[model samples]
Target: MKTELDYLAELAGHGRISRRAFLGRAAALGVSAAMMPALAGKAFAQTAVKGGIIKAGLQGGESTNSLDPALNLSQVTFSFGKLWGEYL
Candidate 1:
C-alpha cells in the first residue's frame, strides 16, 4: 500500500508536481522541513536511458539549403551545421 508521501514523491519525480508544491504538501503531511531535501532527492532520482534515436521537426528549412555555414539562412541548416561541428 502506498502512502500519500509516496504518491507525492512519485509525482515530484515524474515532474507532475513542483518542488515548492511537493515540499508544501509534505510539510502539511507532518514531514519535517529539514527532511524535505532528502525525500525530495529520492523523489527526483532518475536513471538515464541508455540509447535511443531522438528526432525533432524544425521549421524554416528550404530545398535551397546550403551546407556552407556562412550561407545558413534557415533554422534547419543552422542546427545541422552546429551539430556537425561546422561552427567550430
Candidate 2:
C-alpha cells in the first residue's frame, strides 16, 4: 500500500513508516484529522449525510487499544487492529 505519503516520506527518507504511523504523524500535522473533514465539506459540499455501519467480524481480529481486551482474546485473531482501503 504505497500511499501518497509513502512517496512523500520516501522522498524525504522518512524511513519505513507503516500506514498507521503515517496517519498518526499526519494527524499530528493536522493533515487528515483537521483537513479531511474540511476537504470533505468543501469537496462534497452537500447536506446529504450518507452513512453506513462498518461491521468488522470480531471472530478473529487484532486490537491495539489496551491489553485488557487482549487478555480475553488471541493475540492474532482476525486482527481488527486497523483499517485500510476505502474505509480507511
Candidate 3:
C-alpha cells in the first residue's frame, strides 16, 4: 500500500502541492518531524537573493572601440557595456 508520504512526494514532483501542506500531511502521517523544517528551509534556500550588482566581462572589443555609444562596432561588447552602464 502506498503511504501518505509517497502520495505527498508524487504531488510535490508534479508541483501540485505546497511545501507547508506536504510537510503538515507528512507529520500527521507520523513521518519524521525534523524533516519539516529541514525541507522548508531547503525550499526557502533555493530562492535567489535580491538586489545585488552583477558584473560580466565579455571579450571582443578592439582598442579602436570608444566608450562613445555611437562608435560601438561589436554588438556583444556594446550590449554588455550598455547593460552594466545602466546600474552605474
Candidate 4:
C-alpha cells in the first residue's frame, strides 16, 4: 500500500508536483526538514542503468596475485575476482 510519502515521492519523481509543494506536504506529514532535500533529490534522480560494463581499478593488487579465488592472496585480487566472477 502506498503512504502519503510514497505518493509525494511519486509526484515529485514524475514532476507532477513542484519542489516547494512536495516539501510542504512532506513537512505536514512530519518529515524532518533536513531530510526533505535528500528525499526530493532521490525522487528526482534518473532510473538505474539496465545493463553495462563496470570498470574499476584497485591499487593493492600485485603481479603474483592470482585471479583464482582459491589462489587469491591480496585484497585487490579478491575484490577483482568478486567483480568478474558469478556465483549462484
| Predicted structure with the largest TM-score when compared to the true one | 1
Which model scores highest in lDDT?
4
Per-residue CA lDDT of model 2 for 1-88, tens digit only, reads: 3365445355334345544564566565557565534322332233544565657655544444343434445534324333212442
The Cα error of candidate 1 at residue 58, in Å, is: 44
Which ten contiguous residues of candidate 2 have the minimum total lDDT?
A: 37-46
Q: Of the candidates numbered 1 and 2, which has the greater TM-score value?
A: 1
lDDT of 3 by residue, 25-58 (tens): 8777776887656444443335445567757666
The lDDT per prediction is 0.77, 0.45, 0.65, 0.78
The C-alpha RMSD in Å for every predicted model, in order, reads: 8.4, 14.8, 11.1, 7.1
Which candidate, 1 or 3, would have the higher TM-score against the true structure? 1
Candidate 3 stretches greater than 4 Å from native? 35-49, 52-88
User: Measured by TM-score, how close is model 1 to the native structure?
Assistant: 0.44
How would you encode candidate 1's per-residue C-alpha lDDT over 2-87 as one tens digit per residue? 38888888889889998889988998888988877877676666576655553647687788887798998777988877765532
Which ranges of candidate 4 are over 4 A from the true structure?
42-88
> Which pairs of residues collide in model 1?
none
lDDT of 4 by residue, 8-85 (tens): 888998899988899889988889999877776666665655566758789976778866789887778778888877
TM-score of each: 0.44, 0.25, 0.39, 0.43
Q: Count the backbone clashes (under 3 Å) in each candidate.
A: 0, 8, 0, 0
